[model samples]
Target: MPDSSAVHFTNAFDIRSVGCSGDPTMFEAFWRETGDAAELVIPGWQTMSYFSDVGNVCWFMEPLFDQQVRRLHRTVGNAAVDGYHVLVGTGSTQLFMAALYALSPADADQPTSVVSTAPYYSSYPAVTDFLRSGLFRWAGDANSFVGDSYIELVCSPNNPDGAIRDAVLSSGAGKAVHDLAYYWPQYTPITRRADHDIMLFTVSKSTGHAGTRIGWALVKDREVARRMTKFVELNTIGVSKDSQLRAAKVLGAVSDGYDVGGGGASRHRLFDFGRRKMVERWRMLREAAAASGAFSLPAETSGQCNFANETAANNPAFAWLRCDREDVEDCAGFLRGHKILTRSGNQFGADPRYVRVSMLDRDDAYDIFISRLASLK
Candidate 1:
């Protein structure tokens, strides 16, 4: 609960930290500043039932959570919700698996091929093949993948690299699942309302409530949504109702902060606070990368953000840092030797010279990381 604004670091760097995981602890300060806006209280007797809205395809999904999901989309103009079926999951990870299960053919002679562009999210391969399911198999990068039947994952403002992306394969026989977890105004500009067939999002990335363990998907087809819901049913019976309610409260609070009539617009807004923090962090990171002179980051990119009503830069949740030192072949190993833990780009189907650094750690850890990175020779 340390306020990021209050933490300061000197020339001396004493802290060594792990920022390999995209844990969004940076937004803790903003929620704390909001006081009781996002606070939730449920009666002990409530949420005891295993069923919620049995009429819906995702029977366990809370209606309030569903409503807030649409409302938030409308408020931010980040994704198209109209005519989309809102499906809930434990987190975006569960929904991601659901997309694979829902998209894969049951009668295929071979396991359906799943793919993404190079330098993709590392979890895309790990999670796809973890169960060793015969229904689908990870088929490496989409750029090199050659097949008619496939499921391509398009992560916009993609993880690890933050590149705005689209489906690499346009085969009519292939289905694409858009992972827009970081499409919020904080990470990238809302250039247009995303209307992909299957779009996955989570409270973890949007509101930095990773512990809430709640994610919702917007599916255009009823049958696909039904199949995705079945995947959730088979995976965990159903997601936690308490978590759904809590997520609903948090999302509602976010939309409320932007309500013009509610007068909450004058108060601290989540996206505003988030965007400010990310912009500042990206600036610091750029400065550090320059000072080190041994690393290079993606060039800054910006677009007119429909939500923020201004041009915004792509401030990804992770930094795709490439080591420029000719002697260093493995950037991750070099950083690890310096007591900085990061995921190597090789895991993302990219070069070993590059590493993905999490930009969402706590303020103290982030400051120490920036200092250490700047001092790296």
Candidate 2:
């Protein structure tokens, strides 16, 4: 595997790719540093029981998982973990839907309107409407939403655009669920301790371990947590014990790196590693976008990072690119015609001139994307 630096490769897939969780191979060095310590040699009989422990509601969560989550939180000073119930899910997606279910009134006259600002995560509307559940339905932007009862899905820094955001609808009946998958120190500053009512995070974006299929939510309301937990129980009974264990080990390993003061050969801090890689990638992207006169990128966003002890800008998980040239009607289609695939801005409730390009591909593929984007007329 190549270093964390995006490896340069030649292929159709290389140019076609420009999207999420990143290539895990980038973490080859970091994982190898953990060595056999992360290895869990579970005997056949060990996991036969459904319970991971005696007192836990669901038995799959090892105590270490919760502890490490708190440890990492305190270490990074990103989001609050204390006074909150941490519920695990297959990924943030399950929790996202679960929050909507939990927030919507079951006995209401109609399903609660779920909404977010435009250029939102494309998946929000798709997932909410796909099941066509009676509990809640996908409502467009919160800005224009006139309803009194609603669940506002707030993604900060917002996906597709990476803009830091707050709940737009201030109605008394409105409740907000914060999708904080990209709120880590690597992508954005440890701005303030996020202590929202319901905040969702994923291991995928945090550590580039998207395949683990593990995510967690921090909920303040016990009843809300109970309902969300019930939703998971009905959806899949519970999350994967194996995956949770692996995630615990991975997260613990990440914490250990930072705990050791981040230096020398062994203590390679995960956040530091991730932040550096992202900043460099963003620099390359900006240059590429600048070279291409037909395209425009979002203005850089920076703030004082408490973790890094320096001012840092957001190097978001994805790049929101706008086609500035008059010739391009649908930016995504234009890129696709040029052998590149991107999520169109319209999917996020924006115009056809906008496109979301993933910044998580391996270095080689990213290099190709930048080159192709720069050369595109």
Model 2 C-alpha lDDT per residue in residues 158-207, reported as the tens digit of each score: 89799999999888988999999989988999889899999998888888
Please list the C-alpha lDDT of all candidates, in the order they appear.
Answer: 0.92, 0.82
RMSD, candidate 1, Å: 4.1
Off by over 4 Å in 1: 1-16, 262-266
* Candidate 1, 223-246: lDDT as tens digits: 999999999999899999999999
**lDDT, model 1, position 79:** 92
Candidate 1 CA-lDDT value: 0.92
Per-model clash counts, in order, read 0, 7
